[model samples]
Target: MSKVRTCPACADGAAAGDSFCEGCGRTLPSDIRDASVENPDSVPTAPQVSLSGATPGPEHDGRPGLVPEDGPPTAPQVSLSGARTSGPDTLATQPMRRDSVPSASGGPSPSTETARSGGRTATSAPTVPAWPPPATGSVPVKPTNPDLCSWCPGRVRTGFCESCGRLQPRGRDHVEVCAPGAVGVSDRGLRHRRNEDALGVRVLPADAPHAPGAVVAVVCDGVSSSPRSDEASRVTAEAGVTVLAERVRRGEDPRRATGAAMTEAARAVAAIADSPGSAPACTFVSAVVRPDTGAVTVGWVGDSRAYWLSGGPSASASALLTRDDSWSEAMVQMGMLSREEAMRSANAHALVAWMGADSGQIDAHVSTVTPTGPGAVVLCTDGLWNYYPEAVDLAAAVPGAGAAPREAARRYVDLALGAGGKDNITVVVIPVPGGGGPRAGQA
Candidate 1:
């Protein structure tokens, strides 16, 4: 006799032959009697199909005249129909018990028993979506102006304006001056754009007793053709002045110091060229003076000039040091034309050699001059020289005439601006020692 078993859904005890639970009206498996008789470890295996065989229905499982257990009883019965049905299509056609089906959330439940008589593996967990989306706020940038100058215009925006040819300013701090002596710059004309390019260093031994009789000065001109020319000029001026001053302190000859400084500047230019981004080139001209010996040494590249203005009231000023290397000078040197022809040529402004040329050797024009009493040393860029035709006129109008050297430098700059200052202007003046006569405490 078959034993009775409790129904899991209704908790009612039923005999092996019962097809429905008496307590909850739930349906029971027809094979319960056979299942109770078989060993608990042995499960019923699915029926296999052969290539040459008749189609079988779930009614074949010892229940005669009963509805097929695979799907709804009312559905049409078709043998091996390719069409999918909802129920048996999900269970019967699915892959057999090589692996257990995972629960809806993931992983098989603990109650699930392995179809085979061995241990079962835990199903893999489902992947979850990321929470809390990324932040959407973006950083805001300040707007810039469109019609400012490239050298010193504040906050330029549009590269160039159609109306006035002025470039737009990039940002509010585009024209900031951050170094010593940079703040001392004073723009002369209202129309003139103030730029660091026009700034330079003119070092003279302080009237202080400790560093007497030594003076060093530098003049740098920004290449108007390149962007950031102002920065290049400022850096070159400051670095060149500092290095030459240190050399002077070490008692090196001013001529040798000038050459060494140019060599250093050449290295700086090469470094700029080696950098990844855009770099602007510039021209450098410098002079150093030993007031005690009346000796002055000068070094220059490109058109920025140095001149020795001498001969008291009755004497005429001569250009002791002029633009040593330029297109016009090159034409004269190559004998392609006479010096007068080159001077009058329309291409006079062309530069043959400058401090930052990519190719061709840097031709540093180094010269030494010992002037007679009361002479002046003038170092300026083309901006000032372009306007002043005669050295006499420049000497006459130079700032602080008959005053100290520093004052004279300031006056010369002022005069250049007063003369319509179309381009960037710079000037440095050093009065020869023993000319105005030696200062107190000097030999």
Candidate 2:
């Protein structure tokens, strides 16, 4: 008979929100039950690779996606992996997991795992293919209309009627979203003058209670240096989530769906640029996970990130998925600078590419991973990740799947604030349903 999940420390059935194992009093991954941020030793999981296809390496299905106008990247390429994991944050010192990751000489072998006995619903390709323009029809969230002041029937502003200065309604500078399978929260943070980050989450419509499509999560970070960057993030996230979710619902291939959706996100942002030269830009990172396969497809531009958090008797593994499109990453790839040197440089965190009007064609990177156990797919802007530099630290600080996802997101934002919130913080938490599958033989 199949057994329930047991704590790794005590072999006791796992309970919700307990910081320690019930039997042995051991620490646990936050969000497993309550708020969590316990740090574990991080395993470095990125290998330096080179993709030679027109666009670079791995395509959506692990083939080359787009043909780069500049030929191949002058720097060493970090191709997407079909295996499950987050890219190493401390890439230089991180050791490669043993999985015979493909090398520069060969194109990666990607997979197309359709939804079991039904229509398909994924949103990534192993290697990105050429991205076409975004298709139309935007989904708008319900609009909010201010309530009239009880005493003065005037517009409300900061809890006071604009006309009478009478207290009206309380408001928040941030946005909150809650869904059945996922939750997200965006905050301006203590340090930032305004919240410039945006997030979106959706659980795809399932054919039945037992079979669901997948969850789509997107988090975008506005470039502080650019004007109206926050607006850029908002439109990009909203449009991306709508199109991507609906596409999957229609049974499109995940690789094709995600690539087209991200491109559409770019176009949506570009429309706001008034002129191509002064376009506002933001970093985008998103993920789509199928409940049945524990399969994940990830896509991104710039440095926002995604993470897999797994623990317990199933004890699959946890990892960071997407790598940053920053100068340091490029330098590290080119062998022109070591990880330390690249990180220490003033431009280490500066993004090399982003979605904006002036920005040229974006060659988005996509990768897939199927964890054979229970976990959460985390998407966040740099605001949160910057504070937790190491994956171990991030794993500790992030709340686990046990906590309500929206609450977990808020708690994560709180963590960034506690760490001297340096920028806008946005977090989107996606719970991967179904835990404890057959052990994945090797990574």
Candidate 3:
């Protein structure tokens, strides 16, 4: 009913009415709403030239002669840095203001924290309060046994591919992070060669005075089209989570902290590529639990999401807290397209917003939730969510909200891989610590 407003390759953070890529001037993909399931948004009117001098073929899906899948494993990888091709202004070259203002909550003043990344020295200040801290004496992550050979499912013993006969350059391409109450896993999955998705988690010391033991989880999916997107996604996730978590540590307002972090993340990602037109980008989503008040905060760009799996001892209840900034998600929310119809459309998965220099001036979409019972907050990239779009379905497939955070994260990754690992998979699970929770087998 309306002009297509999302970009499949850019899939997570494009603004609602943007007509072209902010990083690149390429025309954005359009959303077509009809029983045909094709994307008119992706249909190009101009002909592209072939190397052999043949007439440019008609475009299909997101782009002609490109993989039909708009996001990674298909073509999402290419647009991670800039949309489509060598368009004129692929990135913003001007300097970005520091998103991290000095903590006003009786912590450091603005003069100390302003834009430290561009090479400024800050006078050391007393440690501000951080939401609960990492668990005391938690064992160092196991160097062996936790990760299987990414190719053959064999234990990556000895840090070599000896048992599986597969050459694993990065040793299973998996990363696991843990804190006092949360654990997250990032995997390359079965399909993609490189794991472009990245995860970050930070927990307060169990004895933290402010929001003791609270945890923050951040997940980002690299735009595959850009060069060295893996690096970009990793940087974005780390920078975003670090800024927010540190802000909380300093007792900053959670909502404002989230906004500041998104700005920090965008700047960090934009700086990843110095060469003009090759800046890398990624989608971002985060979950934070404030145990003292039983509240959960979620912030996101693009489609990466956060879900509250709360309920029983029954543990069957769940709800999606983040609204995807994707084409079809917007259409359904706006009542412009039916849910079933939008999900089935070829352009349904295109991003409406994301993180990167190319994403251009984005405000992180944020929301809060108070669970009725004890549970966990699950934050993940599209690689896992695309397989289980509905919260109920995701809750059903994952371990009950009461399960240990590490196990829960591992289970979700297993579920996605089993359901057909189409892309890189990343999941972070943060358990709600104070309320009554479900028993082990409740779900």
Regions of candidate 3 where Cα sits further than 4 Å from its true position: 1-172, 311-316, 436-443
Arrange candidates by lDDT, highest first: which order?
A: 2, 3, 1
Give residue 125's lDDT in candidate 3 (0 to 100). Answer: 22
lDDT of candidate 1 over 356-410, digit per residue (tens): 4342343455665454445566777766676664454566565323235545554
TM-score, prediction 2: 0.62
Question: All candidates' TM-scores?
Answer: 0.52, 0.62, 0.62
lDDT of 3 at 5: 37
Candidate order by TM-score, decreasing, is 3, 2, 1
Model 2 misplaced regions, further than 4 Å: 1-172, 208-213, 436-443
The candidate 2 region of ten consecutive residues with least summed lDDT is 97-106
List candidate 1 segments past 4 Å from native. 1-211, 274-278, 311-318, 338-346, 357-359, 399-407, 433-443
lDDT of 3 by residue, 1-443 (tens): 22323346644223333333433324445431112322223211111111111222231111111111112110111123333331113212221211110011110011111112112222222121232322421111322344654344356655444574443435325566655567777766654545677777777655666666667778888765455567777788879888988887777766667777877887788887655455666888877677766666677777777776653433324556666656665566456767667655555556656677666554456665455446678988876787776665676676564467777777777777676665677888877753542222221
lDDT of each: 0.44, 0.55, 0.55
Per-candidate RMSD, Å: 45.0, 19.9, 17.4
